[model samples]
Target: MKINIFKNIFENRFSFYRQQGRRQRSRHSQKKERKIGKLKDEIIGLRRRYEKVKKLKRQLQHANLDSPEVKTQRIFQGHKDSSHVRKALQCHFAVLGAVKHKYRGLKNTKSKQSLAQLVSDKLIKKYKCKTYCKKLIGCVSRRKIKRKLA
Candidate 1:
């Protein structure tokens, strides 16, 4: 019956440390899972953005860019006359409704205040409102054309 006192002490200490190590490992795994979740969210965002850009390209592809004379015509400011685009964008976005309410609140209305509700909400304000927006230039041009005589 040879009992080593030093070995017993070391075993007890090591067991405690091992238990602590398990907790640390659990924390580390949780952190890793959070990072993975974030990455997945970012990838989803990128995919949505890619889809939006692809859609814009597809729409632009319908343009007759080779001819300058065909630049400004009718039916959506010479862009395209098709209204079917709503079927595509309406899922992740509010189509025309997301614009004025993308930022802040709609004030006394439904948005969160009827907002949220974004792009595919982020890109709409930054890009779509300016470049790909519907009735933007068209409205301006139409306003100019129909202006009252001074």
Candidate 2:
């Protein structure tokens, strides 16, 4: 009779522990499912936002190609501003004045051409002048200086 009573107590304790473990597992699983649901909602929201941005990008790509602003930008891409042109011309004249002072008696056609080529090269390479070198050469060759000695 005492052995049967001990067995009954042990079975009752084991069953109680088993029910407690099952309850803890169910609670953990519920918490995990709640977190998964929140994550799924966030993913859906991000996908919608991505789709909207992609649509806008496609629209902009198509619209930009036919825009007048783009055409104007292309037309004026390499042309310097008027202020830059003025500054470059001023620098060119200053250099030319110095060259004239150094070579007061330079009169021959070959010597003038050589001097023009030299000036053009220097102005383009060193001074960062945007004017074409050939045009500069022509201008230099045609310039006349009045020398007091000659």
Which has the greatest TM-score?
A: 2
Residue-wise C-alpha lDDT for candidate 1, range 1-150, written one tens digit per residue: 246888898899999999999999999999999999999999999999999999999978897552212322322363554444432333223334455445445445554423334434554554344333344323233356678543
Best by lDDT: 2
- Model 1 ranges with Cα > 4 A deviation: 1-8, 64-150
Candidate 2 regions off by >4 Å? 64-150
Candidate 1 residue pairs that clash: 110-113, 110-114, 111-114, 111-115, 118-121
TM-score of each: 0.39, 0.40
**Whole-model alpha-carbon lDDT for candidate 2:** 0.63
Q: Rate the local accuracy (lDDT) of all candidates.
A: 0.55, 0.63
- Measure candidate 1: CA RMSD: 19.2
TM-score, candidate 1, is 0.39
* Candidate 2 local lDDT, residue 44: 100
